[model samples]
Target: MSHQTGIKANEKLIKVFGKSKNGKLRVIKVSIENEELNCTATAEVKKDWERDYDKLIVPLIEESVPCYILYRLDSKTSLGYAWLLLSWVPDTATIRQKMVYASTKATLKNEFGSSHITEELHATNKEETTFDGYIRHKQDFAAPAPLTSREEELVELRKKEINTEINTDTRHQTLGGVTCPMSDATVAAIKDILNGTYDYLQFRIDLEEERIHVSKAAVVPLNELPRQVPTESARYHLYLFKHTYDGNYQESFVFIYSMPGYNCSVRERMLYSSCKAPFLDDLNALGVNVMKKLEIDSGAELTEDFLHDELHPKKFVNSRPAFAKPKGPPNRGPKRLTRPQEQSF
Candidate 1:
């Protein structure tokens, strides 16, 4: 019976026992199937010897079977080839495996050949299992309905809360409730240092106060600020204050601390104060300045003032130029004057 079949790339076709009409084992028609392309071919064998059949025809047939090639073998003499057609066999795993085994035996007759093949098979299986497990895990994660709306909302809220707490705590730590000392001596010392009058000196307590006030009043916010730890052990807070072009104050503050018995250097202190503290101070100063600039104490006042300024102006000036008398040039081209002779006529 004929059967329709598909073939694979690595399938093998086997030759079953068959005979020709001559009954002399003459016409050997080998039937093989191509697994990949699902085609068929017939080859005529020249010899009926098993060794010769295994050597040439078997290998070719085995290789072709899995690759979608179907074949029927025929017998041949010195003059020409003849056929002893046989029924086609379906390509099966057992058949292919047998063909592979035969081919391996034919090719690798050494004792270690079988062992090497076995090791390869074992390795392949192990890798297959590993790959399968990975695929399964990936599929599990990709499954639908992992998170419900409520769960997603909760996650987002948690993240927001965490961020808020972090920011508040950071602020609290940096600007510790304790007021910084602002002494007169410290202020004078700071001024001297800034003026290049002194190379390096600690601010006296009295000067420090004056310095703080002057610095705070003239503070301008720097672009970048240093990070500070929000812990009780933190030693000092850094701040920056600068004067704006519009005569507004900008200030930033940062908390700073050094290890016990380790005083901060002048450069370090300057950097911390100029960068970190000033950044925070600037945010605060901006809010304050915005309020002060508009001359409003509250949002309500600001809105009222904004409307007043936008809707009406105290005085208005006309931009157009005033009319003036023409001067210098007289009318030219055609004269419009009446001639005395024409008038008389």
Candidate 2:
């Protein structure tokens, strides 16, 4: 989906997009077709924040990192997308768990917003290196250790290794010949996921003793699709990190209109409109670069200044036409009496 505007940086949704049950973030499997992303920043994290960042914060950043390359689709700059540097303490409060400072809006609009975060994830681009390492200033800076020793420990301390074996079983045809009008890249990505039905996936990784856990469930709605999309929206929200087994990390698409009670509210029902196609266009516009970034980060260099001028054209993004409010009666003065007519007669 296109990067939504007015998205607060520290929102819980962004923080936990790929979180699984038990609260221990796991690299379930990324089907590409397969995928993932990266970047880093600097911050002085407190003890509490450092603890959470090690377990929680890092995963959140990894999942959404692809979004940065999306800015490459925008016509505004040479780089094409917004720059982001997430500092645990600076963006979100360790206590409240919500962002408490400087303008995320302005920050996201301008790439390189975080001085310490400016270190590109792929700068070193090591395989197995998923999250762009952040600097914990409260702790003494070690020129040698890019990632925390604890993180290194986690990487090394393999309690048990389980395979998240992935297989491509299903192939998809684009909504019965009604193709989505998206960029080739975006279209391919969608086709990649849809091509296979995630029949099932399961496994487990013992993370840091793997003790505590939390039950997670959600309804992640797909962006409103244009009327032209022929695919049927699924009725249920597929489990976030799994289908049933321990490590099943398959995710499913959530159709906006096809959802149960999606239009249940009378007022909200009035707001329904047919702009799904335009939204798809916008997503595809952003998809090409996002895909490029994803590819380059796999083990190559993606220059921060890679420039592209053509933008995915969007319509009615900001325009809000009046919907339900009644139109006022036309201004008409009461019959001016027969005086003028009678005088003329």
lDDT of each: 0.30, 0.26
What are the per-residue Cα lDDT tens digits for candidate 1 across 1-345? 111233222222222122222334322222323322211333344564333333433343332233211122343444333321112222232333333333332222132122212111111112222324334545755689645555655653443342345553252323322123343433443454345443222111112221232111112123222212121121232332233323655332222222222143332233333333443344244332212211111222223234334334457778899898786467656647886765553
Candidate 2, 1-345: lDDT as tens digits: 122224343333233322321223222211101111122222232334335434433443442222232101111233322222232221111211111111232344242233212222221122223232544321334446554545544643331233255356321112222111322332333333344432111111112222111111112222221221212211111111212223554332221222223322221121122222333334345431121111111101212122111111234476787688886678865656565545553
RMSD in Å for all candidates: 33.6, 25.1
* Candidate 1 segments whose C-alpha is farther than 4 A from its true place: 1-177, 203-257, 261-345
- Number of the predicted model whose lDDT against the real structure is largest: 1
**Prediction 2 TM-score vs. true:** 0.17
Number of backbone-clashing residue pairs for each candidate, in the order shown: 59, 12
- The candidate that wins on TM-score is 2
